[model samples]
Target: MRLVIARCSVDYAGRLSAHLPLATRLLMVKGDGSLLIHSDGGSYKPLNWMSPPCTLEVGVPDDDAREAGVDAVWTVTHKKTADRLTVSIHEVLHDSEHELGVDPGLQKDGVESHLQKLLAEQIERLGDGYRLVRREYMTAIGPVDILATDADGASVAVELKRRGDIDGVEQLTRYLELMNRDPLLAPVQGVFAAQEIKPQARTLAEDRGIRCVVLDYDDMRGVDSGVPTLF
Candidate 1:
C-alpha cells in the first residue's frame, strides 16, 4: 500500500469529467492498483478514485503542466477501458509505502449483518423450494453472503447489500465467475439482493444474466406481522 499526503489538483477524463482544485488530500494507491484521493475529512468516501486494473505513471510535470503550477503528475489508466484519472501535485506533504500483504476484507456488523442473518433464516423468501445451504459460504476470493439451492437444485449465490449499486453487481459477478468454475457448482446462478436496487445496477445485473431481488426489511423483520401471507 502506498499513501501520500499532497497538495494537488485532480482531473478525470473518461465517460465523465471531474476536477478538484488544489488542496491537501490523502492519496491512496491500493494493492489492486486502484487509486483514491481523499480530503482531510469525510466518512471514508474518497473525493475521487480510479478503480483497479489500471496502470500508474508518475513523473515530473511537463512544460505546459509546470507552467500551470503542477510539480508532479500521476496518471492512472484503466486496462480494459480508456477511463483515466490524473493527479497533479503542487507539493507532497508526506509519502510512505507499506507491504500490507493481502487484506482479509471487512467484517460486516449491525443492521446489515443482522439483516443477512435474518435472510439466511428465511431462505424460502428466495422462492418456493429454495433452501439455504449456508451463510458466509467460503470461497477463494471471499465469503459469499448466502449459498442456496433453487427448486431445480442448481446452486444460487446471493450477495446482500443495503443499497444495490453497480459495484455490488460487479462483486457478485466476480463471485459467480469463480464459483461457476468448480465442478460441483458448475451451473451456479447469481442474485443481487438488497433493500433497494438502483436502476443502473439492476440493468447491469440483468445484462449479465443475474437476478435482482428487492428485500423489504420491515417485513423481513416481522414488523408488520398483522399482514399475513401464504409463506
Candidate 2:
C-alpha cells in the first residue's frame, strides 16, 4: 500500500460531479488498484474513493497547472464505469509504501457466525425457490456471507449482520458491484439480512434496489417453538 499526505485539490467526473478544495489530506493507494482520499476527520470512511478494476496514472503538471502551484497530478479512472478521480498535488508532506501482505479477513462474532450458518441451512427464508450456493463466497475484496440463487436462477449475494446499519448496506453494495462485473454473475442481486435493521439502512438498501430481510434468530434457532426446522 502507498500512503501520501499532501496538500491537494480533488475533482471527480462521472455519473455526478464533486470537488474538494485545496487542503492537506491523506491519499491511500491500495494494492488492489483502488484509491481513497481521506481528510483528518470522517472516522474510517474516506472523503472520496474509487473502487478497484481501475487504473492510476501519475504525471507532472502542465504549464497552466505548474503556474497555479500544482506540483503533480494523479488520475484514477474506473475501468468499468469510466469514472475519474483527479488529484492535483500542491505539496507533498510525506510519502511512503508498505508491504502489508494478505489479510486473514474479519472474524464474525458468535451470533453473527451462527446466523450465517443458520441462514445457509434455511436459505428459503430469503424467499421461496431460493437455493444456497455457498457460505463465505470469496471475492477479491472479501467474503460475502452467503451466495444463492433465486427462483429464476439469478445470482443473489446476501450480507448478514447482527444489527443492520448503513455500513453493512454499503458493504453489500460493494460486493454486488464487484460481482455484477463478472460475466457469470453480471446481474447479481443483493440482500441485506439482519436480526434488526435500522430504518436509515433499509432506506439506503431500497434506494439502491437491494432487498432487506429481517431475520428472527429465536425462531430460526427453535427457541421460540419446539420445532427446530425453519418450515
Best-matching candidate per TM-score: 2
Candidate 1 ranges with C-alpha deviation above 4 Å: 1-110, 225-231
What lDDT tens digits, residue by residue, belong to model 2 across residues 1-231?
999999999999999999999999999999999999999899999999999999999999999999999999999999999999999999999999999999999875437899999999999999999999999999999999999999999999999999999999999999999999999987999999999999999999999999999998878887764566667
Among these predictions, the greatest lDDT belongs to 2
TM-score, each model?
Answer: 0.51, 0.53
Q: Candidate 1 at 20: error in angstroms?
A: 22
Global CA lDDT computed for model 1: 0.92
> Which residue pairs show collisions in model 1?
none
lDDT of 1 by residue, 186-220 (tens): 79999999988999999999999999998888888
